[model samples]
Structures are given as C-alpha cells and as structure tokens.
Target: MTYIGRFAPSPSGPLHFGSLIAAFGSYFQAKSQQGQWLVRIEDLDPPREMPGASSLILNTLESYGLHWDGSVIYQSQRHQRYQEQIDSWLASGLAYYCQCTRKQIKQGGGFYLGTCRHKSQLTPEGCSVRLHVKQAIEQFTDQKHGVITIPHQLAQEDFIIKRRDGLFAYNLAVVLDDIDQGVTEVVRGADLIEPTGRQINLYRYLNQPEVSYIHLPLALDEHGNKLSKQNHAPAVDTHCAKETLIKVMLFLGFTLPDDFQSASIEQMIEWGCQHWSLQQLPNSLASSTL
Candidate 1:
C-alpha cells in the first residue's frame, strides 16, 4: 500500500518550533518513502481558534517548503460528519452521554465514576458522550522505541469524545479524520502518547483500519517546559524557510555541512529523502521540536 501521512495542527496560535518539528518529521517520513503527505487544519474548537491563524499556518508551511498534496482538510468544515459519527455511536450504545461536571469528577479524582452511565432519560442538554472503557491494556509499538504498553488503569478512565458545550473533542475528530484520510502511519510529538490508546479504541469501535504510530520526544524550553503557545513560544520564521528546515534537520538527528546549510528547502528535501533513516534519529532525547 502507498504510504499516507499528515500534520494536523490546531489553529489556536501560530506555528512554533514544536509545531514545526511535527510537520517536518511527518513530512520526511512520507517523502522518504515517496508517499503522499497531507495537511489538516484542526479547527474544531471555534472559541479557541485565532481569527487568521489557519491561513498563516498554510503560509508558513509554504515558506518552509512543506507543501501538502491536495487541498487541506479543515475540521471546522466537517461538523455534520462528526455529528453523524457521534449519532451512530449513540445509537449503537458504543458511546453515551454523561451529565457530570468537571468539579464533580475532580472531587472523586481525575477519573469519572460513570454516574451517568445508567441514567435513563439521557438528554443532550449540558452533557458530553464518554466512551465506555473495556480494555485491560492498550499496547502498541513505537517504530523507534521498542515494546510499549499504556496500562489498563489509565486506559480504563471514561473519556469524553464530545464536549458539554457541543464541540467535538479532539480525540474523536482526530480518529475520524485519520481513518477517513486513510493515514498509514503517524509521526508526532511524545506529548500525544497518552492519547494513542484512546484513539486506537475509537478506531476499533468504529471498525476503521489501524494506522501505525510513532511519537517523537517533545521539544522543550530550557526550563523543561514544552514550548507551546501557552508558554508563549515564538512563531517560526517561514521567510527564511531553508534556515528553519536546516534547524529541523539537525534536531531530527541529521548531519549537514555549512555548504548544505545554505541550500534551499527544495534542495534540503532532496537531500533529506536521500539520507532519511530511522537509525539516524536520536533514540531518546530530553526534548524535541524542530
């Protein structure tokens, strides 16, 4: 099968170094195999989205020479589709609405106690659908790291797929999109490692094909915090796209000379594909962001 991969970035803020790493890593993974690479704008949360951030992300990717194949898929435009999947889940009893508030769950600790699981008159008002946990262990391999298993206790927590305020949660939308896009493999930051099992459960619940996954170490500030918009991470310079690409290459465990440092993004991509190998990347690192 032809390889298909993507970089799904939220439009809450500008693309930072952390965002760039994920884009570049997924880009190289696909380009290395001469596969199709796609871009996805994860704009499901309307309130959190910055007004013009999506356009800026596309522009930045263009500047960085991380061109995507086909028109970019926007999550905001797929609300009806998300609703359809949710409705199906509800009808099939694979998912159900829970009316518990955050404070209620917090008093009992982080996990929801499934209080609403058996409530009869299930109403949508101020409620969200939580997936019924069934797995004892959610295990999968990291293409880079060896055998991995997220414990059942962590995986058993009832998780929300839709919000009480009526927005489809990231976990649900991402699973649907990944399956719909026919993603063959996923290479993203380690921050998302926890969500892997939840997404895998959804994929199985929906009976969709399983896609491979790889979670790279996160990029962090010197303070040991992951760089993010919340941390006020600076937006990357897409103007000197090649310079950023070179930096991303070095971060991903590639070696380059001063001469190649001056190369354009297209040239860098050519070189990257030629040299791409899992063995070249760092097996472990404190932090990673392009």
Candidate 2:
C-alpha cells in the first residue's frame, strides 16, 4: 500500500523542541518510505489557542525545511464536517448524548457508567456526544513499541466525542481528520499511546480502515518531565535551523560524519533520509539535555 503520514499539532503555542522532534521524525519517516507527509493545524479549541500560533508553527516548520504536501488543514474550518459525522453516529445509535459531568463520573468510579446512554431527550446545549462502544480493540501492534493491549473496562467506556464546551474532542476530531486525509501511518509522540486503542475503535465504528502507528520517543527535561508547551518548554531556534536538524537526527539514532556537521541543511536532511533506521530509535529519550 502507498504510505501516507501526518504531523498534527494543536495551536496552543509555538513549536518547541518536542514539537520539532515529532515533526522531524514524521517527515523523515515519510520521506524515507517515499510517502506523502501532511500537516494539520488542530485549532478546534478556540479558548486554548494563542494568537498567531498557527502561523508561527507553519513558519517554524518551513524554516527547518519541513515543507508539507498540499494545503495545511485547519480543524476550525471543518466544524461542519465533524457535525455531520456526529449526526450520522447519533442516527445510527453508535453514539448518544451525554449529560454526565466529570465530578459525577468520578463519583461513579471514574469511567462513565452509561448513565446518559438511554437519555435520548437530553438537551444538546450543555450536553456532550459520546460513542456507545459495544466492541473493544483488545490489542494492536505498534511499529516501535510492539504489541499494546487495552483493558476491557477502559475499552468499553462510552468515551466523549464532543465536549460540553461545544468543542469536538481530540479523540473524535483526530480519527475523522485522519480518515479524511487518508493518513496511512501515524508517527507521533509516545505520550499519545493511551488514545491509540480509542482511535482504533473509532475507525471500526465509522467503517474506516485502520492506519498504522509508530510512536516516537518523547524528549524530557532534567526532572524527567516531557518537554511540552504546557510545561513552558522554550520554542526551538529557527535561526539555528541546520544545527537543530542535526540534533534531532541524532536524537532519532543516526550517527553523522564529523564533516557533515558543517554541511548544509539540505545535505544533512538528504543523508538522514538515506540512512534513517526505524530500529535504531530508543523506546524513550532519557532527557532533552543531550
């Protein structure tokens, strides 16, 4: 099958080191396989988005020579499409309106107990939409992490597709967007492994083919915390693009020549693509200090 990959990021902040690692890894992986690599701006949550973050992210990627295929899709512009999918799910009894708050769910033992599954008359204003998960994706094989399994109870929970704040949940939006973009492989950070099972089930519910997954190691700080925008990780220096690219390539387990360190960005990237090894990537990056 023709391989297609994507790097989807939320517009909550500018591109940081962790973000670059994900983008660079995905770009190299796709280029190595001669696959199409696309970029998607996950701007569904308006309240969390920073002003100009979307443009800044695109600019950063370009500065690092990570040009994406086709036009970059913005989740904000696809509200109608998401609504259409939700309506279809509701009509088919695959999903239902949920009125249970976080506190109420926690009080009932954390996982949702289907309290609102039978409540068809619940108003949609303050309600969220949840998938009525009848089947479970027990296990899936990851490209890097090998076999992964989901617990029966966790798999059976009626996960929310839309939030009470009128925003489409990440689980729902990502699955739909992947299908829409024909993403054949999802290469992202290992932090998202938990959601893999949920997304796999979503594909089955929507009658869409499942995509392959490869989760890269996450860059962490000295305290062992993942480098993230929420953790206030500094944005990557686009002015030092070549140096940054070399560092990311090394992080992905590529050994470079001494003279190549002084090579141009394009040459380094070409060498990286030619020598990219999926087996060399460590399960997790110990720290970002390296």
Stretches > 4 Å off in candidate 1: 285-290
What are the candidates' C-alpha RMSDs? 1.6, 1.5
Candidate No. with top lDDT:
2
Q: Which stretches of candidate 2 lie over 4 Å from their true place?
A: 284-290
Please report the TM-score between candidate 2 and the true structure: 0.96
TM-score of 1: 0.95
- Per-residue lDDT of model 1, residues 111-228, tens digit only: 7877887775889998998888776336877888866778666777778989999989999899889888988999898888888888888888887888888777688887878988
**Candidate 2 per-residue lDDT over residues 136-223, each given as its tens digit:** 7778898887897777778778899999988999998999999999999999988888788899999988889999998888888778
* Weakest ten-residue segment in model 1 by summed lDDT: 281-290
What's the lDDT of the predicted structure labeled candidate 1?
Answer: 0.85
